[model samples]
Target: MEKIIIIGAGLVGSLQALYLAKKGHTVEVYERRNDIRKQKLVAGRSINLALSNRGWKALKRVGINTVVEKTAIPMYGRIIHDTEGNTTYQPYGLEKEAIYSVSRGGLNQLLIEEADKLENVSFFFEHRCLDIDVESNTIIFENDTREIEVKGDRIFATDGAFSAIRARLQKRDRFNYQQFYLPHGYKELTIPAGENGSFLIEKNALHIWPRGNYMLIALGNNDGSFTCTLFFPFEGEYSFESLKTEDEIDNFFKNVFPDAYELIPNLSKEYQENPTASLVTVRCEPWNYEDKVLLMGDASHAIVPFYGQGMNSGFEDCSIFDDILEDNNLDFNKAIPEFAKTRKKDADAISELALRNFIEMRDLVADESFLLRKKIEKKIFEKHPNKWMPLYSQVTFSHIPYSEALNNGLKQEKIMDKIMAKPNIESLWDSQEVEDEILSLSANA
Candidate 1:
């Protein structure tokens, strides 16, 4: 059995530890913060995550899907509320397919607990990573009392976006790194459950209020409350910076999100009390140094949350690594570099797709053209399942590589542009001509 040292006990770290331990590795997880289960979670940081097929596959591999499922609320569609309180529902997939809303802290704690139950696994909280000796597979950490170094046969740094291990590697030669911060920032609020423990809105759907420059989204929690997030620019006419007072906060919501404004009774207080957090896209190359140390999850590629794939992608990393390990006969020397080469492209693809989705979510969801296109795509997918799948489905409902999905999505867009351009197309959206045309175009592409 190999000695594996994992940094950060967040969602990715905890899940990876479980996977490694199940593989008979002696695993030790070092976390920088206090045990999350013992502390009240900080707001804004505990953003609800969408658990999709990729994440499910990972949890199933570890045989803990049922444990996490108890806390998950399934969302089958997006419920869009317009400025005038009009609502529209768009199903995410055909029939009863749905994504799940899982609390970040809740899921992380559950995974940690499961990992702790394993004989080969150990967790150390409040142990901050100082640096790493990459060549020797050693980690230097500072505990409450003193500093210590621990060596492992292999090290996996799942330390999140701003990883200390990744920072140290950046100083070395040929380690490409770049960070892009979006102008937008996010804040959290709540739509509390009604008296007698009932949901205030449709409990099974994701609620969204999509204005041009900003949007508000709410996902259901098992406790009958909804975790609402407001995504807006840091500075603009309608932004977090511009809403300086109680009146401004009130008026902005009253005008832009009238329905949500009514649901959130303490909008003003939550607006002022909650902190606004920035969004960043982090991309780095050479996710490994030799065969001793490797980066996984947000440490290698941190993406904006618009696509709802952040946690799903990280969990998928564990699944993919497990496959690579088995394919290489449990050989770390062969698996490490192969993983870096194969996963990096998919990571970059998701990063770009997530950024693009921010625009679609914030602005295009309410557009008539966009909705019409969605209708046509859904019909096409329903009729010719073999020929076409919506980009969203390919990303969320399947385990296809993000790189292939992005390329195919672009081609599908080109074909869709032509299909939508036919005069009087909306009136004949369900016609056989449209179906044949889509199949023909897809075949040609």
Candidate 2:
């Protein structure tokens, strides 16, 4: 078995180490932070992530789906709230099933513990990798209080955004990269469980309060509380920073999310306590440099959290990487480029789509015209079950390519416009035709 070094014992890296170790290889994981499982609460940085079918499938492949499912709260739809506290439930799927609400820290801890169970898997916490010697295939780490070098034939970087490994690879002219920061940023706040430890809203749906240019979203936790993320533009007259004072935050919450304020007794306090986090999308070409080293997860493609696929995509990356390796007769060198060439387009597509979805989530979902089209689209799906599926369905529920989903969505939108223009039965979509088109579109995908 080959020796492997994985940097960053975050969710993806931890999972990778477990999988590789199980496959009979020696695996060592180097993490910059303390062992997450030792902590009682998650770090107060990122909001909870939504894990859909994409993420579940990835975990299922490693025989941990049941464990993850136990921790996840099923979010069947978006419970939308208006300015006056009017509420509506927008179902994510036609069926009763929904996307999952799982804490990033909770999932990471679970994976980390699972990896530790592997006899061949070893972990080094508080080990920060400064750089890697590409030629020697060795990692230089500042472990706790001292610098140490570890030798390995292969290294997998899942070091997250602003990845040090990706930065070093750029110096070798091994790959092209781009990082784009959205004008908007997200700040997380909490609606802790009520005094009796009860959930304020239904525990089975994602809750949203969309206010024109901004949106407040909450995902349920197993502890009977909801974790909310407030997304707003970076520069504006009424930005996150602009609403500084307690009164300003109270007024903002009171005006836009009155229902939410009642559930969160100290809304203003929480807002002030939590720091605002920025959103960025990372794109890179050729995810690996020879079979000796490779990158995955946020280190390779970090998309905005709006689409709720950041972790799911990263997990899928591991699945795809494993497949390519198996296909190439377990030849690491041949597998790396094949992995890069095959995965680049899909990765790029998701990054773009994730950004595009921000507009739909924050603005368009609240628009009447957009809602009308969405309703009609749903109707089409009912009439033509096999042929008509929403773009969200394809992306979240199916393993369809990001590019194909966008193309089909655009096509459906055009056809929807034509149907709206005519308002006649003749203009109604033919279910079989729609099915054939979608099938054809995804056949090669």
Candidate 3:
């Protein structure tokens, strides 16, 4: 068995540890944060993530599917709430396959509990990784309670976006790292429960208020409330910083998002007090240093949350690594390098798509042209079920490669524009014409 050391104890880190342990490797997880289950974490934040098929497949790979599904709240459609407080339902899938909303902390703790049960797995909390010796496969950890060093044949750094290990490695190698900051920023707000503990919005659908150029999104919590994320620009004439006072925040919401203001009792107070988080897309090459060290999750590629694929993509990484390892007969020398080469394109593609979807979510969702295109696309899906699934479905509900999904979506959008102009869906779908247009692109891709 290989000796593997994993850094970080977040969702991605925990998944890597469990997967390595299940492969009969002696796994040790070093986390900088205190044990979450033993700590008092704040509530009413980005408490949950949108869990989809990719994440489910990853959870199932390590035998945690049942446990995760138990905690999941299925959301089959998106409930769009306009400025007037009217609701419209947009189904994610025609069938029962739906994305799930589950508490992020709850899922992490569950993974930790499951990993603790395995005799080969060990967890070290508050043990921050200070440095890594890639040549020697050694890790140094430090905290007030303990100063420790561990050596393993291989190290997996699933540490998060601001990864210390990744920073250290970049200094040594010719790593190309770039972080693109979106003009948009996000803040968390709460929609508390009713007196009898009932959800104010429909508990089953992901709720969104798609304001032009900015938007507000919320997912249901099992606690009969919603945790909403308000996305807005960082700096402008009427940006977050411009609205310096609580009254300004109130007035902004009262004018643009009156429905949300009605639901959130402490709207102004929350807006003034809560932090405005930046949205960034991070990209790096070679995701690994030598044959001894590798990085996964946000440590490698951190995309924006607009697509709701951040966690799902990370989970899909775990699945991809597992497949490569099993295919190559568990040889890290062959597996790690080959995995990087294949996944780099896919990762880069999703980062771009995630950024592009920001436009779709905030602006295009309300656009007549985009809506007409979508209607055309849906008609095509109805006829060519096997060949053409909506780009969203392929990305969220299936195991399709991100690159393929993005490219297909781009081509479909071009065709959709033509179909939209015609006003008759049948004209675009004359068997020979539609097949010729789509198949030509598919064959080339």
Candidate 4:
């Protein structure tokens, strides 16, 4: 069995540790942060992860999904709040299908706890990664005051977007790296539960207040409170910068998001006090180094969170790599390079998709034309469930590869453009003629 050393005890790393330990590997996980179960970590920009099919599948791969289900709150649809206090509902899928809302911190702690239960798995908290000797598969870490070196058969870098491991790899020749930051940033706000721990809004839905250029979203938590986030630009006419004072913040919310404003009692204070976090998309190539070292999760590809797939995709990386290892007869030499070569395109496709989804979520969700197109798409999906599925469903509710989903979405878009161009489409969107046209177009696509 290999002696596997994993960096970063975040969601992905901890789960990975469990998977390897169960396979009889002597797994060691080094985390920069204190153990979450043993510490009181202040709530940060967790933004509440959406546990879709991809994430659930990964959890199930390690035989822990059923346990996780107890803590998750299922959201069947999105509740859209418009500027004038009007609301519209968009179901994410057919009646029974839903995405789950899970606390990032809670889930991370649970995974760590589960992994810790195994005899062969060891967790090193407060152990900061100093550097890596990629040539020898060795790591130098700082624990409190002194530095120590640890050697392993393989090193897995699951450190997040600002991975120290990936930083070292970036200095190597022939390594490709890029980072793109969206003009937008996000801040966490809250809509606390009412008396008796009752939800102030619909508990079974994801809440969205979509403006022309910005949006506010909320998801229900186990404690009945809704964690809300406001996505706005760093600097612009309508951005976080312009709303400098409490009055400006209050007025903006009161005018644009009347319903949500009424629910969030600490609107201005939360706006002024909470931190504004940047949105970044990170990409890198050659995720593995000759079976000695590898990059997983955000270390290799960190996409914007608009698609709610960042965590899901990371979880998927573990499952995919595990499968590759089995397929290659547990040969790291074959598995590492194969996974790196094959999964790169899927990761890049999701990155592109997440960026595009931001436009649809923040702007098009409330647009009349966009709504018509969605209605047409939904009808088509319902009628031809076997032949067609909405892009959102495919990405969120299926195991379809992200690259294939993206290609299918592009073809569907071309068909939609023509179907939307038909005279009086707004009135005849539900007609059989439109369905036939889409079927014919897709056949040729």
Q: Report lDDT per candidate.
A: 0.92, 0.82, 0.84, 0.91
Winning model by lDDT = 1
Pairs of residues at least 3 apart in sequence or in different chains that clash in candidate 2: 387-435
- Model 1 residue 238 CA deviation (Å) reads 1.0
Per residue, candidate 1 scores C-alpha lDDT tens digits across 1-445 of 8999999998999999999999999999999999988967653336788999999999999999999888788899999999899999999998888999988988888999999999999999999999998877778999998998999998899999999999999999999999989999999998887887789899999988988888999998777778899999999788888897999999889998898988898889988998988999999999998888889999999999999998899999999999999999999999988998899999999999999999899889999999999999998888778789999999999999999999999999999999999999879878888888889999999
Q: Please report the TM-score between candidate 3 and the true structure.
A: 0.94
lDDT of 4 by residue, 281-370 (tens): 999999988778889999999999889999999999999999999999888889888999999999999999999999999989988888
Tell me the TM-score of model 2. 0.93
Error of 2 at 79 (Å): 1.0
Query: Which TM-score value belongs to model 1?
Result: 0.98
Global Cα lDDT for candidate 2: 0.82
| Model 3 lDDT per residue over 31-122, tens place | 99889878554555646899998899999988889988876889998888788888777788766878999998888888888888899999
Estimated TM-score per prediction?
0.98, 0.93, 0.94, 0.98
Candidate 4: stretches off by over 4 Å: 41-46
Candidate number with the higher TM-score (1 or 2): 1
All models, RMSD in angstroms: 1.3, 3.1, 2.4, 1.2
